[model samples]
Target: MIEALAPVFAGPLDFARHWLELAEAPEPLPRRPIALSTLLEEEVQRPLMARHEARYPGGDRRAALSMWTQYYCAQYLLSHLGAWLLLGRMLPFRPDDIAVLVLEDGTPDGFRLPHLGAVAEGPVDLEPLIREHLAPLFQSLQRHHRIAPRVLWTNAAVRVSAALNLARQQPDVPPLRLLEAEALLAKPCWRDGSPNPLHGTQSRVEVEGEMVLRRRVCCLRYMLPGIAGCGATCPIKEGQSAKPLPLLKSA
Candidate 1:
């Protein structure tokens, strides 16, 4: 099954490779999966918790803390799972195939709740499944940092319209606006401050027999002060052009 699904998740390898390069590690990669797990556990998870504690002292915001922890953990888990899948790690079952266990009716031995169903089924699409399940976790992270997820718009018009309509219902929430409204340009950046060779690469698209130049954009979220929600920095041309773009503008 793992071998069969390899083609479906070929992108994971690229994702892992990008992260590895950002971390400034050598090529060929390490074969020990346990070492990667330990690295995440110690470096990622532990430090994230410490940061959370430092940000919110005395644990008053337990719910927010839980959400942040879940968000970071879910990201770490999904990334590792992706890397594992790419590495052809022999596992008893595919990560997405495993059903989440839900206790219906139970006591120490057993009990019954009259109005409950079976465990929630996992999504057929692993990426979306991971994203949806981890939504609450990400929300928690945002809450702790006093940030909210920006509803991003893709090229898909239907999704954009739906998102716009939804945003209208929440008065407190910001209104739907074009990505251009923020005057943001997405530019790829190495997370670890390393230079990316592909930086500022331009692609030309012919529209009406006229060639229009547009550079590739990479959007990412981070916490910033005075921002109600998590701030998205759409880096265009590296730090040379820092622009604020709508979080949910068309991509």
Candidate 2:
């Protein structure tokens, strides 16, 4: 997959190169890599969460998990969307087909693709990503932690919006790519008619005569010790207490 997309990884789309990788000799992969599917297992997630909690003595579990979700989602969304918008090709993104590099302390490093899936053209549908990859991952995280599904969805939405913005800023990106991204955000619902979680996840506000984008949902990073908030992009109000949100009971 890396060889096939090599040209696209150069010049303006170089940022996508870091987020996606294709591995040679699938087995014996570098680092302490774990299959993304395995990460979903209840047994696998417990120790990972424990590692995170230990790192921040008094930090809330939901905050730790929320930060982790943002990391993984950003990896897939940026790489996948960048390829589609710039190269008009979709690399494999199925959970079963991907692995993530995990550090000893349980933080995710980067994505590793051992195999490639079908390549599709531009104006690609994002429903499969939300339905196939994110929904199940978020469900599993909620099963093991106190974070709300809405919080996870909002985190994923932020990355999705970021990918579109990144692609739009590229000088070589096609007009169709911009139009597709705009239409997707404008639509109130997904193709399945369900509420589009990506919608309204961001808003543009004036900051010193400049319009800056702000996320509608707080990532709760401020609840962790020694971690700084997202600054201007954060939806948290000025002087708001850095408290983890009330634990959301699972359905």
Please state the error at residue 17 of candidate 1 in Å. 8.8
Candidate 1: the clashing residue pairs are: 68-141, 105-111, 106-111, 147-229, 147-230, 148-229, 152-248, 153-248, 186-217, 187-235
Residues 1-251 of candidate 1: C-alpha lDDT, one tens digit per residue:
12332432343332322221111222222221222222223343344444444443232233334334333333333333332222222222222222221111100111111121222222122233223333433444344444333311111111222223333343442222222111112224334454322234334556567765442332221222111222122223431233322333212
Runs with alpha carbons beyond 4 Å of true place in candidate 1: 9-132, 151-251
By summed lDDT, the worst window of 10 consecutive residues in model 1 runs over 102-111
Candidate 2 worst ten-residue window by lDDT: 238-247
lDDT string for model 2 (17-106, tens) is 645556663433334667779988999988987776666667777788888888778777767666677777766667798777776777
TM-score for model 2?
Answer: 0.83
Against the hidden reference, what TM-scores do the models get? 0.25, 0.83
